[model samples]
Target: MKPHVVAAASLLLIALAATTAGAVTFNATDAASGTAGGQRFDQAVGLAYASQVLSNASTFIWSAFNQTSPADRKPVDAVTLVVADVGGAPAFASGDVITLSAPYVGNYSGDVKTEVTGVLYHEMAHVWQWDGQGQANGGLIEGIADFVRLKAGYAPGHWVKPGQGDRWDQGYDVTAWFLDYCDLLRPGFVAQLNAKMKDGYSDDFFAQILGKSVQQLWQDYKAKYE
Candidate 1:
C-alpha cells in the first residue's frame, strides 16, 4: 500500500515470482458440511470468495513485507483451505495449508465476511512468512502475521490499543501494535527484521535496525502513549 516507499517493480516482481504468473493454486473443502458453522461458511463465505481472498492476501502480504524480489519470499505453488468440525481458534495455517473451524464460524457474531477475511489475511501470512527456519520465537512469528493483518486494514476491534501490552513480543495484536510503531519509526522495519530472520532471530536485531535494544524501544513506545 505504501507505494512511495519502494518502486512498483518491487511490488510486482516478488508476487509474480511465487509461481507461473504467481499462480497459486487454492482449494477449499467443508468436512463439516452438515453443521451450523459449515452452513455458515457455505452460505456466507463460500469457496470462490475464500479463494479470491487468498490471492489478494498474498499480494498484500508480499507488499506489506516489502518483498520486492523473487528471493525475498517463499516459493509457494499451492495452498488449501479446509473447514473442519473443531473448536477453540477460528483458524490456523500450517505449511501451505489453512483450516478454519466450522463451529467458530457458525457462532461468531458481527460481520462474518469481514471477520473471516481478516482471519484469512492473518493465517495466509503464516503460509509465506519465513519463521527463521523454525528457529524464531513462535510468538514473534504469530505477531508478524498479525502485523500483516493489521497492515491490510483488517485488524479486529478487541485488540489492544497502541502501546498497551505488557511486552513488545507478547504476540498477536500486542506485538502487532508494537511492530506497527517500529515500522513508523523506521520504514520497512518489519520487512528488514523478517529478512534478518530468514536464517535465525536475535534480540539484537532490534538494536541493529533501530540503534537501540528492543527493551529500550518498548519503553519509548509505551511512554509515547502516556
Candidate 2:
C-alpha cells in the first residue's frame, strides 16, 4: 500500500467521526510516487493535506453556488485527486477525478501548498458545477470554476486584474472578474446563473438575471476599470 492510502484512511476516519450522513468521500493518490516531482508533493503537500483540501474546496464551492441542500447540487458522492507526471496544464478535472501535475508542484518556485490549494478549489468547482449539459460556453464553465476559486480567496497573483479581458466569456480570470462584477450588481448572481445552467446556457441569462445583456455588462465592467 502507498503512503496516500494511509492518509486517505485517516481522513475517512475523521469524516466518519464527524458525520454519518451525506458526507462526500475524498481520496488522494500519487501515481508518480517515486518521481522527483511526486516526492516533492509528498513532502511539501502530503496526501493528507491534499485530501483535506479536496473536502474543503467542495464545501466552499457548495456555499459559493448557494447549494444549501443536496437537491441544489450535483449528484457527486465522491471526489479523487491523482498526482502524476502530467504536462501542459497544472491540473484538469474529468468527472469527479482531478489530476494534478507533479511536475508543476515540484517546479513551483513560490508556495506550492497555496498554489495547489487554489488549483484544487478551481477543479473542485468543476466536479460540482453543471456544464449546461455540454451546451454551455466552455469559457463560461471555466470562468465559473475560477469564480469559485476567486471567492475562496485563492486567486493567484498571475491572474488578470479585474475588468481586463477581451470579452466577458473569454474565460478564466477574465470571466471570473466579469462574473464578480455581475454578482456585485445583484448579490448571488453567480449562484442564480449556476442554477439556470442546470438545464442549459444562454447569453441571455445575464439579461434574465440582471436585466442587461452580457455585452453591455462587459462594456460596463471595462468602463469601470478604464
TM-score winner: 2
Alpha carbon deviation, residue 47, candidate 1 (Å)? 0.7
Instruction: Assess the local accuracy of residue 85 in candidate 1 as a C-alpha lDDT between 0 and 100.
Output: 95
Instruction: List, residue by residue over 1-226, the lDDT tens digit for candidate 1.
Output: 5776567655343223122126667766676768999889888988778877888888888888788766778888888788899998889988988999999999999899899999999999999888877788877988999999999999999888988989888999999989999999999999999888888878899999999999999999999999
Structure candidate 1, residue pairs in collision? none
Give one digit per residue, the lDDT tens place, for model 2 in 38-134. 8898889888888888888887888888998998888888887888899889999999889999899889988888999999999999999988888
Q: What lDDT, from 0 to 1, does candidate 1 have?
A: 0.85
The TM-score between candidate 1 and the true structure equals 0.88
How displaced is residue 158 in candidate 1, in Å? 1.1
lDDT of each: 0.85, 0.88
